[model samples]
Target: MPDIYRALGDSTRRRILSMLKQGNKTQKEIVDAFDISQPAIKKHLTILLEERMISERLNGKYRIYSLNLSILQTAYQEMLHYIGELLDEQLISLKNYVEKGEFRDEDD
Candidate 1:
């Protein structure tokens, strides 16, 4: 969970992840898409790799990166659970308000 939060904490990493989702890309290609330095891009990749959110393959001299998708599943599941709970709470609140005559009219 900490890794998920850390991986999502940086905008550069998020951009890299989004790009990788489209297709695999070499280190040079990822760096070219950003205005930052190569070393900076490498740092972001390192964090993402440690979190297992992305994977890399050595293609001769180039390291190609792609999204792992599995580890990212935890983050997505967490978000879904949170959203479901919020919606349930709101529905209960609406029900209570209606029952208590705090949000009702005779128009119906």
Candidate 2:
């Protein structure tokens, strides 16, 4: 989904996801891992939350966030499929070119 791609577009957000992949973490815990300000990290978390890449739960005074693996897996699979289709198209074009004797060898 476009949301997933957008959520993954930033290195900071990707790192946050990688952290969540290890285990659930509190907002403070996530904030501590990076050198950036808490508000900056919070913004990245918000985007991840909006994309449903992470889920949040209130625990007393703390909010815990965890990766939503199913959503991530679905997005990853779809991206792989898209990449495979592109590669397949390129290969088909190369095959056609060769078949028509139109491919050139620079060494020749």
Candidate 3:
């Protein structure tokens, strides 16, 4: 989805996603993983949450962040669909060229 793409467009967000992929992490743990300020990390996490790319659960007073794998799966499916469409068009063009006898093989 566009939201996912927008959220992933930033390197910081992408890195955060990679970090979450390893396992869920607390806000402090996430902040420690990066050289960025805690506020900046929180901002990235907020965007990821808004895009549904990540989810948060409260563990007592701590907030644990985890990757929303389903959201990523959806994005992967969309990409596959787009690639299929492109391949279909190319195949159709090849078919047309062959029917017109315009596609001559080098071996021929």
Best by lDDT: 2
Tens-digit lDDT string for candidate 2 (36-78): 9999999999999898999999999999999998988898898
Task: Write down the TM-score for model 3.
Answer: 0.79
Residue pairs with backbone atoms closer than 3 Å in model 2 (clashes): none
lDDT of 3 by residue, 1-108 (tens): 636678889999999889988999999999998999999999999999988899999999999999888988998798788889999999999999889998678998
* lDDT for residue 92 in candidate 3, whole number 0-100: 99
What is the overall TM-score of model 1 with all chains considered together?
0.75
lDDT of 2: 0.92
TM-score of each: 0.75, 0.91, 0.79
Give the clash count for model 3: 0
Q: Give the best candidate by TM-score.
A: 2
Candidate 1, residues 1-107, lDDT tens digits: the string is 62687898999999999999899999999999999999999999999999889999998999999988777887789878888999999999998988888864679
lDDT of each: 0.90, 0.92, 0.90
Q: How far is candidate 1 from the true structure (C-alpha RMSD, Å)?
A: 2.8
Once all C-alphas are superposed, what RMSD does model 2 give against the true structure? 1.6
lDDT (Cα) of model 3: 0.90
Residue pairs clashing, model 3: none
